[model samples]
Target: MALSWALASGAQSVTSGHRTLFVTLSIVVTLVTLGITLWSRHSTHTTGQFYTGGREFFAMQNGLALSGDFMSAASVLGITGSMSLYGFDGFLYAIGFLVGWVVFLLLIAEPMRNTGRFTLADTLSLRLRERPIRTAAAVANLTTVIFYLLAQMVGAGALVAVLLGSSGGGTKDVVILILGALMIVYVVLGGMKGITWVAITKTVLLLVVAAIATVLLLDQFGWNLSHLLGTAASKSPQGKAFLSPGLEYGKTVASRVDFVSQAMALGFGLAGLPHCLMRVYTVPTARTARKSVGWAIGMMGGFYLMTLVLGFGAAALVGPATIKASDPTGNTALILLAQAVGGRPGSLGSTVMLGIFACVAFISILAVVASLTLAASSSLAHDLYAAVIRKGKATELEELWAARYASIGIGAVAVLLSLLAQKMNVAFLVSLAIAMAGSSLVPTMLFALFWRRFTTKGAVWATYGGLIVSVTLVLFSPVVSGSPDAMFPGVDFQWFPLGNPGIVSIPLGFLFGWIGTLLSDERPDPAKFAEQEVRALTGAGAY
Candidate 1:
């Protein structure tokens, strides 16, 4: 289909044969994915089936799905593009992302599965009497999902504009609307079952594409990664930038510290993300959750290592000029590199590369948006509406309907926000989301899971304090403030460097929670504490 479109649009004859082939491949992948998703829709019924795969998924299946959830456009395309452009600085992001999974595996996965019925809020409010705590957690969850959806929307617009050969603002808006609608369908109709299967399929395809691209590049360069790296180092003033720490390239000491600290913040922040944590509940057992996380960490780690090769390969083969020309948006490094490696339009290799990447991009966005919708819906339906508003009196069917409605509302709101924040960089927006998750929610979650002394008041204060500090810092950060050159020229004030405040905000979360607990007279409930500990450690109550 992509090929036909490319041919019909004159892309085949006008551009290199490689370009046409690429488009053709992309169309085929999209059609296949759409067909599968549609065929699977009839099987998805009830909220359990939609949200947690009926809690029947095996460890391996859930693990792949988890990888799918983790491998957003930010990981697949963004990381590749970053490495292609920034060299080692880009790989730093990948390392942080992958290593963060270790923290998730060790501390979050099994416990989250054991304690939460369906969402983060369920686990959080299990031992607490405070409606305020649940509401605050929901707020944090919503914020993270919205920011994440915005980044994915931006990425979708960029992908559509590149693939369709349209570069107008209207084109981006249309793409965002279409992507948003697709996500709603995936979540509302297909539910968790649909999301999980789609995610697994996308992960397999991503790994295959990475393998093929890596092998081809290595073969082209006599299978020498070191030689390729040396060439890239020789060509760019950012010599050996791919091998050393990102701080080495910082223009000043402050910039260096900011860069390294941001990387560290990002690494730790992954453990706190709502979408990532929600997946833990999909598996049947806490043990299964732990194993799934282990698998995800390994799989993701391998993928990140592959990205280093792709990035250096792009630097070596595509040249900076072409990358700059084709990737003005800075998100098309992999696409441009594929074009360079596959040769001009009409080539078999070029066609395949283009098709694979296009498919990967589409699937990446689909899986993530679906997860975001699910996260938002869970918070609203399970946490806010069912648990609090109705005091658990709502029937299962009512909860399901509420979730579907929430999905639509969340999708609409996200689309609107994406439109409003259209000018923001995708990476920066993603970082902000991670920072928010890390700051506001991670401390409370960790304390609730491991510390028997953690109180409801403490959790509430920690969540709000983290939210306030992180949001304020991010809003006034370089990305939003237009540092060095304000959003409106001449404005100056560097509230935070590197645009992500997780490093600062996460510690503040801990401090606030501690202080709040100390000031409150309330003590941990003995009965609730024992119940939660048993559930978290023994996989007794996950169902």
Candidate 2:
């Protein structure tokens, strides 16, 4: 009922003229992205350029692209909306995300840059059994990337719901299909070069729009944060409690544990995200990868700080009641805030503000969808098809065709799944994907890089074991079937109390890897371990 009401409310809030403006902006942005893709296509004939942009991007260029890839619509629109409704608890997402980027830089990026050729599987298959190791890595990669794709598409669906404004289901489905088609073209025609530039373009626009919104918001309050906070608190339903941590996650012991688990997921998950790992190989040297991450951190940090102000600004200007009435999940908080900040409903400023923010959000979603699809298709071609099926005999032309077709297939699957699961909570799907990554990929990569005695069995175990446990736990948890906000609230099949399984699944992934290593009869390759260590640390003999 809340979901239906939220959708209907959101539909009613959008005016017909504003809806036309959104479509106009989307078309303009799509044409621009297509032009960028065409310009980059000539350079992407080889697999290296298709996958890593030929390792030629400077730190600043790649940094902005990294920021583009990392800062999804989920983080910008969703997190600001989250903070608008949940206050301090929602602020935790920014902290966890920033900290996770730092963790990836310090622990994951340099080693990956120094080691992998194409995919995350390349890094794991360094010394392990190529077939089984690549297979397992591909499975984990597809699992995480697909879930992320679904999350982004769901956000796209919500945007459609808002734009259509009470239109019939057929119209909304067409919009989603158009979106899917655009995403397929981005990956198939442009590849990494196009995707990188698309990301760079959208990231700049998103940051600029966000910064303007933040400055205008602050100006309304005389540049005094205290006044903003005071107004937000006074207008919020929870009042003073809205300024504290307990409003969202502190009501019960189980909820508190789930909050901690979620924090764990975000903190470690970014280190293991397949798409982020792929970004490392786009830089020439490990030092460049590190420097690029540094640049990303600085830019993303500025963006998150702006979100804090915007989140509060939304609450102060739009109020909790209007926000919840429009969208129960708070996804529309930014939109409503934009409308409010732009002056009267029929004014030109209002229309322009809505158009700019909506356009950037639309572009951001498409870019993220394309990136995820590319990651999955690349893994399918390079890891499973070339390595496992062809035994590494496939030519570059065959591999490229495989990747292009795979992108179309994966994009279709994601679009279909998004339509099917349109009623599911977008936040739940994203959290589950990250938790799975934290549990499965993190342990496998950590051991592969540092453990001298780690074996092929251990890597396989860690990857499959972590993924299986995370999904199983969530299936039986409140997030899936039991709670009011669950995907299937009509039933009560939940056995686990916590919403997130990260705290348990992550440790077990490591333990299972260790145990699997000890139980295997296979001997550890000390020579390979030594080479890996040298390459990971000193960039000597690195690909």
Candidate 3:
């Protein structure tokens, strides 16, 4: 909600020791990142290496990297806070996020690996008119990437401020700048290889930290899962309602609709996240790609399960009123929980645990931003500059250089936007990002892979129509101007009711694809479609 937040109730103050430990741990993390980047930078000597990690990563390696990309600090804070605040309904995000991988594994992973080289646009260009398809996909890619980048950057700033126990205004801005600069350095120097290693490392650290916290929390409740829930129900303001569905989304018809919209966004949107999907290309084979997704699913699934303990644990330990007072979004809940479970609030044990979470959170933000920046720059360089601007005449070296330069440009834009929108609803922006990803990419990519009748016009319409409608709807929706938490609280132009546009825009993506294909005079080529089908299914003639 607001950028200005006090420490959580239990954490009335951060000890000097705690702040020093956090700074030290953070410095160690930064150095580790640079070390990885330096090594990876040396490894990246070709266009293939820069864009796809030279396709040498094993299944588990790429999978953990993929997990690193998907699990942002914003997501961890938001989901855990939601779990603490809304109980069961908040767990829906974890469910939706994990289930999206099923769609990816079944429908996208193998095909994407077989068809794409560096970006999704490459897969579409095989059958569609290369220019329009690539341009539309690139635009959608950049738009989605920017939103995700902003969400992560803003969350990073806020979380950093919270960890340091500083007032947000200037402190948050400074963190955003520093994070942006580090992200630029990571992508410009290390590229995909560097980003992959960073993500792998981040994921491991997150799992370890989360596991330790869960064990400590369970021990606090005598290792009884049922006891924890009972205690959480006892402590929450809503009492027993905290364990039920209606507490959050079932309260009203509009709220119910928002629930469905949210489910759609998390499920399909995560599946279609451009950056996440492109990681499949980094693995060596389609089988490895599929296995990597399986690995990602398992890893994230375990992590989501852990959120249950942390979330309800916090609710049981740190009261909702205290959490809301500190930060309305429930972010302070996690830090407060860290403090509470580690030991007495403000004590050495509690603050040390809090400091550790801060370190992992900082790395989580860095890992995600680097990956998104890589995807954004790769789309701009490979799809737009080399393919569109130079008409495929650009050499490998020129394209590689273009990607590095594009990373800086993209990082600059993200930093500037994050600073401008720091006070806006970061959660709302994140939802819109996921919704737009689903609407813009899901239908287009699915049709290109499965539907024999799919054409360039269909791809173009699906990408542009879904992208425009979802964004336009959100612009007029409560997120932008009507409700108390709206981006512009002083305005009241909201006409749309749903907070997430996924339910409406997602189906429209498919409908627009069908409509555009029928409207186009250009006939689908059977030979090319045959080629694509064989290549997609059997991995024949794949790059």
Candidate 4:
């Protein structure tokens, strides 16, 4: 009876029955994914296939995969958890994320698809000198990918540990390692084809589960949205504050500025992310890429809308105290909500619901980590190794093998770092990753795509300089020290006031690009700009 009550309040650990079911479903999904990988070997033999899924996917398939890649543990779990605890402030994330996609659809997607060969570096190198620009872009790609990967790994390991009721430090490490190895297998063996299938499959499952849970939640409130919000506000300890913006970040001028900076990062950073940009290259043509982005925005917008309900549902049903008790970050709110809605603990319905959520969460982690690993490995092989190191002389076979090895290496490093970083907050890392991307990649991409006078020196300076400033600021920021959410709580050396560096670093990136170009003696190359514009607009020589 206590277990049954705990389900409604989300105050206790998962039941043993649910854990068993969760483990079983996890195994089934893992085996199925591995089978898909094996089957994909036929298409992955060529470099184009391995890197871009042979550029064969149509608009809808690529759109679903794009949605899958964008909707990570952070988007589903982190944002919902924020909503459950912070209410109106949390919905700001949904708005910011959606706005970022508008940037991609209007500016980045079509041209990126038309110009790039395999990676983001390929596009940057089109107008600039090959070696320096490629190397700089590769560094920017790896920095963003590794940070994003570490956050995902930590969240996955923690979520799996909670589902299985395992608390030992070694068990957490082992979970991270296995998850890393599983993702590496998806990238190394299956490449883009296998990864795309997994993304599309998992994203649909995640959306379905969310939709079902939302419907059940609506049923409890007589299908009235206002009633749900009212119940959530009454149940929350913050009361009316839970329905307003001040609960999370509106307390002081400084806090508001930091919030704005974070919002900027979320709004502009999606266009700059290497993994998201790489998705554009998978479509058959520029027109298909634009259509795919439109589809992805629709799906993602619907999902975020559903999260508002799920967030309120968790607040009204499970309460914030229990959510924090399960995980301080409130990432387990949806899992608890799933069990509560299904039935009382130990019931057949509860067991089935718990099993479904376990599989969903596992697949969410797998899809995101696989994309990140692929992105990082592509930078190493296609950009750094083949272009910079081998002077564009390496054979396709050689580059492909290099990519596989790079995936394993990157996974291993991420697993170890994630294990060490278990105490850090996943949400903070996600925001940091976005801010880094906005600071480094956004400026360079805009200048290269639109400005004729943008030189190699300017591009390199923006990439490397923006990266250094962002990383250095993060190292000294409050997220790393001096507060309750600090990664190293005992340390107090925080100097940067803002939690995110986008507001400051992004402008610096653009300024560095402009200043570098002005100082460089390299003559303006209008012809190169014309050629790139022609290719980007007309889709010539894209394949």
Best by the lDDT measure: 3
lDDT of 1 by residue, 1-543 (tens): 000011112122224444354457656765665666677678666767766878888888888888888787677666676666677776777777776888888888888888887887788788876477778888889988887888888777766565666656787798789888888888887788778888888899888888888888888889987789888776655666545656233668766766665766776678888888888888878888999988888888888888889887877887555555555333556776676666665577676677667768777787888888898888998888887889889998999899999999999998888887766656566777888888878889998888778888899998899889887887777766655423333565665765567668888989999998898888788899899999888877667
How do the residues 166-247 of candidate 4 rate in per-residue lDDT, one tens digit apiece?
A: 6656767888989998999999899999999999988899899889988888998899999989988998888888888788
Candidate 2 C-alpha error for residue 192, in Å: 0.5
Decreasing TM-score order of the candidates: 3, 2, 4, 1
Q: Model 3, range 1-543, lDDT digits (tens) per residue?
A: 112222333234567777888999999999998999999988887889999989999999999999999988765677788888889888888888887999999999999989888899989998899999999999999999998888888878776776676764799899999999999999989999999999999999999999999999999989999999988898888999888887888989999998899888888998788779889999889999999999999999999899978999989888787678777867778888888999997688887898999899889989999999999999999999999999999999999999999999999999999999887677677877888999989899999999998889999999999999999999999888888878888989999998888889999999999999999899888999899889989999988
Residue 390 lDDT in candidate 1? 90
Residue 383 miss distance in model 2 (angstroms): 0.5
Estimate candidate 4's alpha-carbon lDDT, on a 0 to 1 scale. 0.85
lDDT of 3 at 16: 71
| Alpha-carbon RMSD, each predicted model | 4.2, 1.9, 1.7, 3.4
Steric overlap count per candidate: 16, 0, 0, 0
lDDT per residue as tens, model 2, 309-358: 99989999999888888878787888888888887775777777887888
Off by over 4 Å in 1: 1-31, 240-243, 246-249, 328-330, 482-490
